[model samples]
Target: MRNNIAEMEFLYSQESIATQFSRDKFHQFLQEDMIFPLKGVRKKYSKNEIIIPEGEVTNEIYFIESGNVAATKDGENVINFYAENEIIGLTNLLLDSHSEYAFQVISNELFVTKYDKESIIEKVINTQEGYFYHYVHMQNQVSQMIEKEQLLRLPSEQRISLALLILGTKFGEETNDQDLIGFPKSISKGMIGQYTNLNPNTITNVLQKLQEEEIIYPARRAFYVDIFKLEIKLDQVLKK
Candidate 1:
């Protein structure tokens, strides 16, 4: 693979260097020997493409540059969805084992920077910035895992409510009227079921209830959470 030095920082950029240095200065620093690994490539995938097959040994880690990728376990249950600027396969790199879940491109297309796992680990320890970036990444990963565990312990109705809240927080965009926090686009109920490990029937019922209560607006293609109502419900749950 031809080295794409400048793009490598996207692999684990908690804070982009572009904000700190001029473009030319940033490139100049990267050009120095061993500052960042040059063993990476930029790649793209079409929608529904399998980026990383479950059980496959992943020698490389991917940093998403754009679009969305869904990580799923058992071919249907979603572990999580990753969007632009998030690194995939970091946990796999740390474990040094075959991938526990499959990663698939869910949007029309996906762009990612791929790097060798070993090279990344080496550089991460040698550089303070890299160390801090990886540290934050790991913390975020652990927090998400803990959140998921908490979700799993809730009753299905509360669990679904919390799942929608999580998705809305991650992918929501403010509406023109500022009353709704809608996702970039609609997501299917089946996908929601996959994420929450709830049955299709249960998901449909729960969503219908939420819609009737005006806590959310659900549609066949996608749904939007009522930010105000959602916050109230979340607070209620927290106080329980």
Candidate 2:
């Protein structure tokens, strides 16, 4: 028994080291091969913290290192949620226009890498990879806008499911058990309702239905939705 346990420990150690090495190599490739050097001032923010207030003229662009942020047009309504590896506040930085939305940290462990627009433009944005990144980001925003419009027309349950799926895709971890995953942090029902323009009671009813169907499992304030099952249900709802 002792020998078996030692073998298991060794295997775990090997796996951990291999994973770390792969991550290191990937980051190194990004910096050297791709010539994409990510240089910024790292910042930490708490939950519900406001990073950029609406109508504020700012020259800083932020890259999310981890955690999630909600972009709100009104103080109470969430227009979009940004997750890890996403960039925000670029429009104000690139153009002279002021921000039309407020950006608030929605996750407790929000880690952001901030860059001064002037410095970035002078140093990075002028480079080839920088231009590519900028173009890709613009395309992504355009697609997101299109998605938001489509979501507005979806039924509340489907909208909520799609929202959760987006969050899971952007910031969730895959599990071995029934392939369950969702946001790493708990999101409030009120926030979800605000994002989907649904009432809390309606959201609750939908959640209960999902739970009954075994499509989702609740964890604290968040739900670990089974992606395959949810997609199937969404398809069924859309067809009907």
- TM-scores of all predicted structures: 0.80, 0.78
For model 2, how does the per-residue alpha-carbon lDDT over 2-38 read when each residue is reduced to its tens digit? 4433543455564453443332232232345335455
The numbered model that scores best in TM-score is 1
TM-score of 2: 0.78
Off by over 4 Å in 1: 1-34, 37-39, 94-96, 184-186, 218-220
lDDT of 1 at 74: 87
Residue-pair clashes per candidate? 2, 0
Residue by residue across 50-89, what tens digits does model 1's lDDT show?
9999998888888787888888898988888888777788
| Runs in model 2 lying further than 4 Å from the true structure | 1-39, 92-96, 123-125
Clashing residue pairs, backbone N/CA/C < 3 A, model 1: 186-222, 187-222
Clashing pairs in 2: none
Kindly state the number of residue pairs that clash in model 2.
Answer: 0
lDDT of each: 0.74, 0.72
